[model samples]
Target: MLPLPESLRPSAERLFADRLGLAERFASMLAEQGPERGLIGPREVERLWGRHILNCALMADAIDPSARTLADIGSGAGLPGVVLAIARPDLTVTLVETMQRRATWLEEVDAELGLGLEVVRARAEDLHGVRSFDVVTARAVAALDKLARWTFPLVADGGELLAMKGGSAAEEVDKAGKALAKLGGIDPRIEQYGVGEVEVPTTVVQVRRRAQGTRKGETRG
Candidate 1:
């Protein structure tokens, strides 16, 4: 199994605290079974700690302290979803994946780690109007414009959509502005976490859903 690098220990220790072992076990499973199951590329095994686990864990810092529930859409290999559940056990975490095999794998990981995650096998759009969450998240799922359409509705009024993005975060936010307005997403901004703690900081595009009673397409007049 690939070992967690010594260089990243400080950051890992800080993000996970007492639950670091759970994160380690999850990484071990990813390194061992991820490639075979097509959940992750074999090349990713080498950097599983820095590139995947820690990267996801850093997002926990951006979560609202009052948040009680979160849903991770397209939680393939359980990236931020499983990682966040391990880090912040206070919040109820749900892993939503459209693929059957991936959903099954998430369920297995949830049971093995006893993380108590809700594994839902369906497209995010399918859950719209049926269920919602205090916070909704997605990583490498889709472009911001299309992603907003799929994820925004799942965010409860006054809740947030925290999308883990890459360097293009700003561009995506700019491009999704109109769609965001239509979806009642407000205060869109790019926030970075683990700036000094990690080699590469995690970029998150955060948007809050405007409260209901305000029409979707209505202007603030």
Candidate 2:
């Protein structure tokens, strides 16, 4: 199990309620998670409340107000996906995951909560159809370079890629430069945060997937 809230103090429960309004539902989901996964122990739930929920909500800073649909790849446990679904109901969130169990969990929760969402169970590459979204997001899924491949086609022209990266994201951005360019993403930028004591580092990675047939795909700084 993951660590509980990196820092749980006064006013945190309120944050949980505000940020994660459906705390009781989330707790119920967490209760079912480990047993469903068949790994049971003790992992602090508060930590997840702050680090995951609050941290995920921070992605909003990267998105354009025009964005209404978001695709969260590998949305295991629905950190950012579920959080976004609740926090921003205006967003038509698509939780794409290959794992059936996790997908079911996501689907069940969304259905139970009546949150507007579309859950797709398939490999990222296998996805087809007009699934273009305004924002494509991922957290702790793969390296940024590989992530470009994982997330590119899912984005429509003018959409953005929000990557939740760790400390020293600049190096990863450098490593992913070629990949992001190939995927028609540009103007990547980093944002730093601290979840209480733990550094909540991530990259907003504002990108405009260039229109096809354009000569210069990368958005100029």
Candidate 3:
């Protein structure tokens, strides 16, 4: 049994209790196989509970209760994608990774965890016209500007892109303005999120897609 930070324990218990022993199983896999397979760094094993798993699981708090499907772009090692599925079984998650090896690892982890998430081996841009999602999630993937270009097209009308970022989250949002405008993204703002499970709050930049027929840089005249 891995020890969780005292403040985070209760929340973890609540999140996992009804779901079975998911937390434990996920921790074990990450610690044992994650490093060996190069899915995570050797130094990351000790921090998996706090930095990786719990952090990603907290993303569930940002998801809309009515959201049915979520796409995790650049889902290397399934970060938030796998964790979110375990935390919220009601969500249909798709893990999109351009690397075959990473995609394979996602599939393996999904089967092992029985997460029921779909693993798609393609970059976000490739899937733009083929699929759309109610929510798009990304973490440590790219700068907000480039990320917006790749992800905004995949968001269903009225859907949102929730990107996990570090302390520079606000700055990223500011810099992504022009890119967002070009991509038809609206309301790009930084949101403080988390379940009180970690010492620092989770920072996310949320950008919503404009509803159909609404044009960016246009006014009803």
Candidate 4:
């Protein structure tokens, strides 16, 4: 099993609980299939717990517990998608990757981890009218402007787009202002979470869609 930090153990135990076994299986998968499929760098295997798993899992704390549907776009290694599924069983997480290899790996991981997630092998733009979800997430996918363009259409009215960002979270939100508004997003804000847990808290650019009443007759952009 990958070495989890002592400080993170209790939280992991509580968050995972009955699914702890699935968590271990995921760690092993990242160390094994990850590098072989070029999902993660070879040197990253050792840092999987802190850098990948925890980094992604921390986003769970930022999401609303009541959200039922979540889509992770450009889910190369299922960073936040698979981790979120392992952390929150109530959420129906979908891993969306355009590449066949990554999508196939995600399907395999989903079945092995028994997370019961959906794997969609299509670009975000193609899924515009096909479906929508309560929450959409992406990590290191693209610049916020481009990300907004790609994902904003997939968010259901009254739902949210939670993009896991870094130091540039605020800047990206600023840059994405026009695109976000054009995509029917409102109330864009940067929220920093995981304080006291990870040295640097995870920063998320949370953008909420207009209320259904306000978005009447609005179609995907």
Alpha-carbon lDDT, every model: 0.92, 0.70, 0.83, 0.86
Instruction: In model 1, state the lDDT of residue 136.
Output: 95
Clashes of each: 0, 4, 0, 0
Clashes of 3: 0
60-137 per-residue lDDT for model 4 (tens digits): 887887799999999999898999898888999888999999999999998787789999998999999999999999
Q: Which lDDT tens digits does candidate 3 get at residues 1-221?
A: 55566766776776666763776777787788888888899998888777888778778888888899999998987788888888889999999999988889888888887888899988899997889999999999999988998999999987889999998888888889988987778877787766355766678888888877877744222
What tens digits encode model 1's per-residue C-alpha lDDT throughout 65-106?
Answer: 999999999999999899999999999998999999999999
Candidate number of the best TM-score: 1
Off by over 4 Å in 4: 215-221
Lowest lDDT sum, 10 consecutive residues, model 3, at 212-221
Model 2 misplaced stretches (Cα beyond 4 Å): 1-20, 31-41, 128-130, 193-203, 212-221
Better of 2 and 4 by TM-score: 4
- Among all windows of 10 consecutive residues in model 4, the one with the lowest summed lDDT is 212-221
TM-score of each candidate structure, all chains considered together: 0.95, 0.80, 0.92, 0.93
- Against the correct fold, how does model 4 do in TM-score? 0.93
Candidate 1: segments with Cα more than 4 A from true spot: 213-221
If ranked by lDDT, best first, what sequence of candidates would result?
Answer: 1, 4, 3, 2
